[model samples]
Every structure is written in C-alpha cells, then in structure tokens.
Target: MPARPPERTAADLLTTFGAAPHQTPRQPPTSAKRGRVNRPTAPLRGHARPGHGWSPVLAPLPVYQASTREIGGLFPLLVASPMPAVGARIGYDVQSGGAFYCHPVEWVLRNGLATNPNIAMFGEPGRGKSSTVVAFALRMLNFGVRTLISGDVKGEYTPVVRALGATPIELGAGNHARVNALDLGPLTARWDTWTVRRQRDELSSVLGRWVQLLAALAESQRHPPSVSDEAALAAVLRRLVGASDGYTRLRPITIPDVHRELASPDPQLWRDLRYESRHDFLHQLRPMTDALANLISGALAGMFDAPTTVAIDWDAPVQSMDLSRLRSRGDTAVAVALTCLGAWSSLATGLRDDGDIRIVVRDECWRQLRLGPRAVAAIDAELRLSRLEKIIQILVLHKLSDLYSVGATGSQAVAIAKDLIALCSTRVLFGQSTRVADDLADALALTGPEHQRLTGPVNERRGRALWKTENHPAHLVQTVLSSFEKRLFDTNAQLRPTAGRGGGVGRSRG
Candidate 1:
C-alpha cells in the first residue's frame, strides 16, 4: 500500500550518484563482467514512446532532507536548497590488535538542531568530558553560534571563555566566597520576565520547597521530627525573607524539639532530604540564587522589546553562564543555574533563527537524566518530536550507571540513554573501564572490529572513543581537549608546560 520510489536511503543515493565511501572496496560480482558497468535499457529514453512516455514515473517524492518550512513550500522539488554540510567530527580510541592507539574526535555537523535527531556525549570523569565540551563550545563560537557553558562549579573554562570575548555569567559562590541569595519575592518579580515566566515560577517553587527542606535538615545535621517540623521550617524561611505576604509564610521547628516527637523514621524521606533531589531544579533556582538574577531578570524583561537571544544576551560567548563558587550551597547550585540553563537551551530550540543553537552540557549527564515522578513516554516523546526542533543537545556525562539510578524505572530517565545513543548518529565514548564500555558497545551491536576501536586504549585523565552511525560504519576517536589544553586557558595566571608526548600525567599506570 505504500507509494513507490521505495524510500530512497543513503545506500540508494550512494548507488545513484556514487557517494565515495571510506575504507577499501568490496569484490565485484563475477557475472557482473569487470570494467564496464551495464546501464539499464529504456525504450524511447529521450522521447515519449509508451503510454506514460518521457514522464515515466520519475519517482515518488522523497523527503529530500529540507527544512520543515522549506519542504512545505516545495523547496526540495526545486532542488535549489543545499544540503547542510556535515564534516565536523568527535573522536574516540579503539583497539585493533594488541597495541593501544588514539583516534580523532569525529562528528559531521549537518544542522541536526533545526529538526529532531540530537546528539549525546557519555564518558567518565578524567575522561576529558568537560574538556571536550569546552572545545565544542569554542568551535560553535567560531561558527558565530552563541553558546551557554553552565555548570554547578564556576566554569573552569571561564579564563578561556573570557579569552574568546564571551561574557561569563557565574552563578553561585565558591569556597570562602559567599553569595547572599535573593529571596523568592524579588526572584519571582525578577524572573517573571522569561516567556515561561509563570510556569517557571511554579516549577521553581516545587523544587525550592524540597531543596529548602533538605537544606534545613542538613543544617540541623539530624532527622526532621515531623511533617509539622517541615511546616515550621517553612515558617522560618518566611520570617527570614521579611515576608508580609502569604507565599513566604514558612515557619521553623527546632530540630531537637521535633526529633524528640518523632514516631517512625522515614528513611527514604530522610535520604531524599539531600543526598540529592531532582537535578533539573537548578534551572528553576538560578534566578533566585545567582547574583546575576537581577541582571538576567532585566535582560529577560527587555526581551519583549527584541529577539530572545539578543534580549537575554544569555547565549552569547561573552555571556558565560557560570555556576561555580557555590560550594556551600551544595547541589542547589547545580539545581538552580546549570541544570536550568540546559533545560532553557532545550526550551530555546525551535524558537531561534539564522544560526545553529548548540546546548552544551557536561558532568553527570547520565545522572541528570535520572528522574523521580516524570514519565519515560514524555521524555522520549519530547526527544523524538520537539526536544531538538530548534536546538541541539550536546550532552556530556560521566558513567553508564548514571543513565539510570537503580530504582527509578518508568521515570523519564529510563531507557533514554539507549534512545539517545541510537539516534545520536555520532557516539564518541571516552575512558570508562569496567563493563560500561563493553556494555555500551554490545548494546549498539557493534561488530568485533568496532569493539576493537572502542576498547583499544583508555586512561584515567584522557582516553579515546569509537562511534557508530546509520550511514557510516563504526569509527574511533580520541578526546580532543586534554587537561593540558584546559590549563592553557586557565586564568589563574600560572603558566606551566604541558605533559610531554609520552602521555604521562605526574604518575602513569604501570
């Protein structure tokens, strides 16, 4: 029942116009008579001979990779629009024989951001995950694409980002440097500027309540006494905010008083108190906690006056979305700014024009995908349908286990790692010993040759990766930005020579 033209594919295109493929050629068929290739016979090739004549079923209209808007207006039919160029690569290392080697970080940037089909980067610490992100951000900046480099810690990339003339929007404070957080009222009034103002307010409140409760408990260094204690804590928060309003109606319960009244201890509730809550909360909290809140608020408020990117000037290179310096605040720092910035990037997709919008995420990405109440269906739906419509998600994470916390199944976090890898088109994995590298390779169903490239050689601080795609077979890549590369941009003002080509960092594994 499906219409003809038989769904043209990369293979079909290669066969048609002879797309040059990498690697050696396969043996030609014996019956296919060597040198000269046979051409299909056609009667009246130039002129109409039969009933259909020269119009002989040209081909069912294939969706020839045009913009959604362009396709609707028949741009593909005109054949005037050029295909997006894809040559950029992300590298990884893989093994071939007994010796270990490195490969180039490979990626073909075909403007995947405009449509769906996003990208992902998964690796472990010391694997150069953050370094890789920094290089990509630099590259995007070179392309004139504005970017936001956000993280819980102030970007170690600040020196380099600043060097690029990008503004550094540092959120949270570092050790010895305390930042006085803005209260909810001012924050709400401030944040009511973004397009998602109201919704963002609600989400932040949900996140803030949980975060504050945990903060209070952590402050007490003891278990919360009761639900009343939770209420009391809320009151204390209200009083501190100088609240004459109803929203800041939080009260405090003394820890010792509540602990004495405790009936049964809720271990899960206690644990949820702070080892962590939803990592996404960071985005919600950024406005309330950052010194940049008012600055960002003003920028957002001016948005109704101009373009979104221009309004916030948030995405530009000079505007480094910094989250470092908030050591004392703990996970809240990540929850407020870094996490929210990533979410905002995803939100910004489909809303931009002209330049490509690349959202670069680093550190514990697999862990971030881990969720509590959200639905996997929703996450997958967003990713497949609209998540990357206008923005490309450049996610870099640490471990395979971070993809899914032990029990959080059915949550939006489940199986998304797999979906991401499958649709990634480019999967550049770095150093992760254990079964993670092995399991990921197996999951992708990489061939023996592919496995060799992925598992070839890996180190703690730096390693290579191998990639697989629908069009291209498996290939290997190495971490492009090493620690030495990062130290070059460090503003600490200390200049040190990089480790020599022998690839030793202080001490190497014997």
Candidate 2:
C-alpha cells in the first residue's frame, strides 16, 4: 500500500531542524557578483595557511573558569639551576633540562667553595661507580690533568690505564714490578725547596706515614703497636736518613735496608733505653720488623723491597697501581701496599709545582683504615693538605657504614673515619638498600626530600646517582658513556660467565 505517500519521517524533520522548516536545500553563501564564492573573513596578524584559508578572528572572546589542563600544565614542579659549564660534560640536568659538567678540583678551586677538593663516592657493586670514575678521569686528561690511582682493589682500572697508553704497575707477590719504599724520585723536587728544618719535618712526616702502616699491620693482627714500638720506629727512621759531615745524607733506601737497621740497632740507640724499656721496645719493634719482612721478603716480597723497576712518570696523564694481587693476599697486604703508594703519591705531588691538577683515587678505602687510628690520621692529614698540593683525592666504597666499621662504635677509629668522610667536598651516592639508605641519611645529613628520593622509586634507575656539592641541593644524575668507554671501562667482562669456546655450555664440542 502507498500508506499515504509515506508520511514525512521524524528523522527527515529532525535533519532539517537547523534549516528552514520547509526543508529546502540550503545554498552556499555567494558574493553579489556572479560566479564568485563568498566566505567569512577576519583581520589576522599571523601567517596565513597555504590552502585551508584559516584566519585569526578579531572578536572579543568571553573568559571561562581556568583549570590546570586548560592552562597547559605539566606534572613535576622541578626548579633547579644547571651546573655551570666549567668542566667535563658528564651528563644532563634532570630538573632544568641542561647539560651538566663536573671537575672536582676545578670546580672547588675556581669557585672557592670548598677547602678540600676531595670527592667521596658510595655505590653498591655493579652500580657503575667505577665506570663513572674512569670516564671522569679520562675526560680530565684532555685538560692536562694527571690521575694516580693509589689502589685498584679489583684490577678494574687496568684496561683504562692501558687504553690511555699508560702502564699500570702490577704489585704483588712474584710480580717483577717493585717500588722502592724510599725512591727519592717522588721526593727529589720536594727536598730541593726545603730548608733544613723543612727537610727534617718532611722526612719525619714520611716516617710517620710508614709508622702508620706498620701500626695498621699490627692492628690487623690483633696486636696494636705499643708506644715504645712507635718511638723505636721514629728513631730508626731518623738514623736511616742520618747525617753525613753535618748534612743529612740522602740515599736510595730499600725496605730491606730499613728491616736490617731495625733488626740490628745501633749500640748508642740501645743505650738510651733502660733495661726493661729496651726489652719492651725490642719486643714491640719485633712485630714491625716482621711486617717489613713480610712486605719485603715474604708473601709481598719483591713488590716494594727493591728500587722501582720503572719510574713513575709524573708527566703521564694516568697512573694506577694494580693491587688486585695484593688484595687477594688479604687485607693486610693491601694495607701495606696502599700505605706505600699513598706516601709516594703524596710526596710526588708535593714535588711538582706545575699548577696542573692531580687526582688520587683510593678505591675500597675501608681496607686502608683497618690499621686503626694512626693510619686514619695519616689519610686525614693527606686529604686536608690536598688543596695546597693541587691534588684531588677520591675515596670510593660501598657504603658510609664501611668507614665506621674499623673500630668500636664510639672509638677513635670511628671518629677518624667520620672525619675522613667529612673532608670530601663532593659526594656521589648510588642506589642503596633501605638499611644503607637510613645509615647514609644521617651520615650525609640528607634532607627529608633527599632521603625519600634515595629510598623511593627514583633510586631504581640503574646507573643513576645523587650528586651533592657544598651548599647545593642534591641532583639525580644518570652517567652517560660512549660506546668506546663502555668497552674500555668494563670491569665485569672477566667476571661474567660466557658460553664455552665451542659456543654451548653443557659439553665440550671436540
């Protein structure tokens, strides 16, 4: 059926509601002139679109309630000034979207912000701490800065030293490389500038460093050095650098020579002590002699007993002593080697007046403090004098707690450790376990926000760390490395297990 010619549908009526009720097709607006299409136009101030013909509307716009989304908002409300561009490009600033540069010595010296140019780094194993140091050192070389690593506990820095065309002296039992404890090469220039009193004081200072090492050795063996032992050591050192014709005779001294002098004391020196005092002094000095012997002729023999096989060229951009072998021998051997290296490095830097920067890194710093308070004092003194020497010292370890672990909670050892940590003007900390974070928060004097950051998800970013400088807020930085650096500074290549030579691990393919 036609159904009354299909009554007008509701859809059809609704479709034409915006137009005339008669439902006639709307015609496009046209100009009064024939064949000319018309369009609405407005005055504009911006460049016009090429085709679409969109123009700015010059009309009074109505204002509406403003909201964050409507105002083009962002999430994190970060406000930080980028580190000045005065040093090596290490990474990017997370807060300010700027490049970050770092040079511990340069920054401190230039800004006069810190009295000590020493740096302290704490990170868990496998957190890229070593790599950051290696990269920083390599970059520093470009600026003519020289670096000396006093102790490479894991031999991790050998590749970097070699890559830079510098030789790494491997010191341990049976290694041909030997560093004469008294090689004057490091002290020659220093002695030249010294007056009689200064020379005596300098030599005495060296003797004191040696005594610290010996005492550390004794402490490790549960036999702390007695006062008599220390006095005897001072006396022996004075005699070793004895006077010749009213002038102090300076000669190349070996550890063996020092050992010999101790074993057979001068009759006049013995005459000064009472019978009981002499016996006690001898008894105390015996252990020191044994420590010297062990380092000179026992397990660590030949490493530092003779003249240095190869001179440490201060002109070289990088120098590192690979103490991995000695580290394997136990903490005692490492302590002794570290002591010698520290003394030598300090004297060497003192000898130079080039005004160029020098860096000394002591990885696994806790091992050196095991020798008790004397060693700690020696290191503290070195750190304090670093500014005058133009030397920047870096101490790298796992956690801040390591420093306090040397002695009882309230002992002088702990106090010295704390002082040593306090000397660092720049501090870098990687992600730590919750417990370590709590300990460090107190030790580092971290703010509430900093503590939360360290213990929160921000800490989960691998290779990312919080860097703090004097009177500055901590920065969360991710270290950047080039492909070459990634390979050159890899410390775990040897440690990682790989497939067998034939490719599979289960069985050998013969």
Candidate 3:
C-alpha cells in the first residue's frame, strides 16, 4: 500500500486553523463548563497531504481538550482540539498533572497490535514499579478499560486488586480457585478439548523437545554410564510416554530428578548407566530445585484455558498475593514464587468481564518468554492472550541484559511485548548528571532555552522522572510511589521463601 502524505507542518497547521488558530470555537459538550474549556484559535486548519484537504487523511486519532497541561514528555500520538493528552487520551497521572497517551477511543477501536505491542515499565526500587502501575490500570478499569494484569510480582498488586474491588482467586484457597498448573482444568470440561487431528498434528512437532529433555534427564542416571548410556535410556523413555500425559503440569521431570527416578525401581538399568560423575553433578545442582520450580510455575501460567470471565464482588476487598515470605529464599526460589504469582495474575486477568485485567508480569518474566521449546512456547503463546482475551501485560525488568540469562532463546522476550515506558529517561555523567537530558532536549528538535527548561534538573527524589514525547525533547514529571520500591530488589531486606510441600528439606521456614 502507498504511504500517507507527509504530516502537516506547524505553519500549515496554524494557517489552516484560520486567523484565530488557538480558538476554533468547537461545539462544547453538555459536560463542558463555560470557563473550563480552552477554545482553540481555530479547528485543525492544515491542508491535507497533496491528495486531500482539511481533515488530514493520514493523521492518527486525537485526544480530548484538557483544563491544564497534565503529564509531559509522553507521545501525544492521538490529538484532540488543543489538547496534548486529556481525558481518556490520558496515560500517567501524578499529583502535579495528568499525562495522556493514546486516545481511549482509538485504543478501544484499534487492533492494539502495533509496533510496541506490550506495555512495559522499569524503575529502581521505590519508584512505584508495580503499585503505581496497578493503580494506573485500575483507573483505566473503572472507566471500563479492557486489560489484564498477569502479575510477575504478586505483592505489588494487592493494592490494585483492592482498589479495583477485584476478587482474590488464590490456588488452594478460593472456592472458584483450583490449585493446578495453567489452570488447565477450567479450559474445557470435556476430555477432548482439543480435536483429535489437532492433537495428532502437534504430537511429532510440539512434543519433540519436551520428550527429549525428559529423556536426557533419565539417561544421565545410569550406573555404569557409557557415553551412549543416557542417550540409550532417553530413547527408551521417548518410546513409552505420550505428549498429552508427558506435558501435563503435574508431570514434573527435571534433569536431576530424572536421574533420581531412574536410579529407583530398575536397579540394573541405573547401575548399567555408570552415572557416578553425573551423580556428583546432580548433587551440585541441588540449589536449582527452586529454579526448576520457577520454570514450572511460568510454564503453568502460560497454560490457562477457561471461559475468561471473572466477576468481582465490589463489597469485598481485593486480596493481593503475599510475597512477604519469599525474601530470604534462594534467588531461583524467589523466581519460582514469582512465576506462581504470574500464573495466578494471568488467570485472573484472563477472566474478568466487568473491567480490564492488568496482569503485571515483572521481574523474571523474561525467563518464561525466553524458553522457546515447543511446550513452553505453546504456554507463552496462549497466555500472551489476544484482544479477544482481556489481558494487558506490564513487564518490568531492570537492565535489558537480564533477558539473556532467561531459559528461552532468541528475542522472544522483546518480540512478545507491545509498548515500552522508559522511566526517568535520564543519563549519568559529571556530578551524577547526564547528556541524555541534553540529547532529549535536542531531540524534541528543541534548540533554545525551552529544551533546557523541560529536561532541566536531576533530582534524587523518588517518584519524579523525565521522559520525551514524539513532539519534543524529554522532560520531568512527578508520579506516585509503590510500597515495594527500594524495599525489595535494591535493598537487602527480604522475605522468607514460602514453604514447599514435604518435610524432609528445611528445618523450618525462613
């Protein structure tokens, strides 16, 4: 398709609006107050591209007029009569003012599968990463926004569940809740949820990696262990197990665990494998039990299949997931707990009918998205729900490098997301200042003091930030803070890991 004509210039815009370019005198809505509205000099008066006139055919949608400049340095993609970001066009709102993102109408109407397909936020501790974003999602929800919160960190979202009156659907707790992986039971009541042909089609392709991985684990456990021993064992296991049963969340088969399982029942098979060196490696891999757990929970979250409608009782307070217990736990264990939380969040958001479901997939979420083997890929793809499913993921991660350590391959993490919110768009240099501010000022295509004014000041204060919009250079904006910021990741303070099943492990919970 041909491109739309070049966007209109400022002068062309002004002249098009006619003599009173600031006040076009549009018909005010019934809700409009006489003094509150800013009558633009004139309607958008720019000529269309070479082919058209008046209403620029190529222009994106618009936002509503605002009483005052609310938030700053955000893309005012959708425009409105003299309003940068007003009303539903609003995005972030701090005490100082409100900022607009895309027009709500456009958002409601558009496919939402644009270049930036996922929502993202990043900040150092205490910058209100989850808390602030939760409230933001709620505000959108109250206005009947369609979204879902697949929470990566559960504790950060309790405030959100409460503020929105969303019910707590905890596994092993709520009546409606079932403590199982992927919440798959609810996907289809009947046994044949998937067609026979579909299942068969997926068998050879989808189950390949999963079966191989499990087989490798079993092979590593043999006693005499020839170099080809483990491979031989894996071949045997693959011949016996089927995908449907093998891929079940309940069927956890880790590498070490596989060795342990093989060592039992079939003593000769275990002994013939000559697994001494591999056993030592297995012992060293003890700490990874938690990492395995994290992978499990993540894989599970990606498996939810249900009616996708959750009704909340406004009278009851929302219950947030308590991660207060995960502090002292091993880092990998912490990651696992978070995966459980994300699974729950995704499940909750996938089913809300009354409002948007804001699933905040933060912290180590890239782990699940990164693991691209068929089983895990299917999980991620399903949970990365489409518009038909009311789920909007707010992925939060610190340095982009962390995306590397995650289990999956390629740019699966970045490829899955839709939008990015670069917080405090700043730089560090002499005396703890940065050239990013200068670059931001220059990039708004600003030359004079105005750019300096917007990108000015580097404060140590929390909740205050700088950003840039399509129209101009980066600037500062104030926002509310979340409770967990500075308290969790950046600080030493931690939560004890939640108790796992079985009593043989720890003396007591931390």
lDDT of each: 0.41, 0.71, 0.37
| Stronger candidate by lDDT (2 vs 3) | 2
Model 2, 115-234: lDDT tens digits are 578888888888878888877788887788888988787787877777777788787755688777666665555666678887777676667776665566556556667787777666
Q: Which portions of model 2 miss their true places by more than 4 Å?
A: 1-82, 110-113, 189-194, 243-245, 273-284, 294-297, 495-510
Model 1, span 1-510: residue lDDT tens: 866777774435444544332323344445344454443223455445454333333222223443345333433344321222232323333332222111111233343322233455666655666666666555555545455543435356666655655555554332221111221222334343445555445434533443333332222222322344444334334333333243333222222222222222234332334424333223323222232223223322221111122222544563444555444454433433333444343333323444454444444444334432122222333345333343344556565555555235564345654565554554556666657878766666767766655555544336455544444555454545546555544332233344566432322101
What is the Cα-based TM-score of model 1? 0.47
Per candidate, the number of residue pairs that clash is 52, 1, 66
TM-score of each: 0.47, 0.78, 0.45
Instruction: Specify the highest-lDDT model's number.
Output: 2
Looking at model 1, residue 244 earns an lDDT score of 22
Model 2 RMSD to the real structure?
10.8
lDDT for each residue of candidate 3 in 1-510, tens digit (9 for 90 to 100)? 999999984435544444313433444444344454454322486544563345433233233332223211123443332224422322342223546343223333444313222344434444444544444454454445543333323344444454444544432112243233223222223225556664444333323333333322222121122335334334334333334354332222223343344333244333444445546434433333233333334433222222223432323333344443344444433444444345444444444444543333353354433332321333344334543454444455433333333334454433333112222112111111335335434433545654444334323444444433333333344544344432222222234343565322211111
Q: What's model 1's overall lDDT?
A: 0.41
Q: Which of the predicted structures, 1 or 3, would earn the higher TM-score when compared with the native?
A: 1
Least accurate 10 contiguous residues by lDDT in model 2: 501-510
- Look at candidate 3 and tell me the lDDT of residue 179: 33
Which ranges in model 1 have alpha carbons more than 4 Å from their true place? 1-117, 152-154, 174-311, 344-355, 370-388, 406-413, 458-463, 479-486, 489-510
Superposed on all Cα atoms, the candidates' RMSDs to the truth, in angstroms, are 16.4, 10.8, 15.1
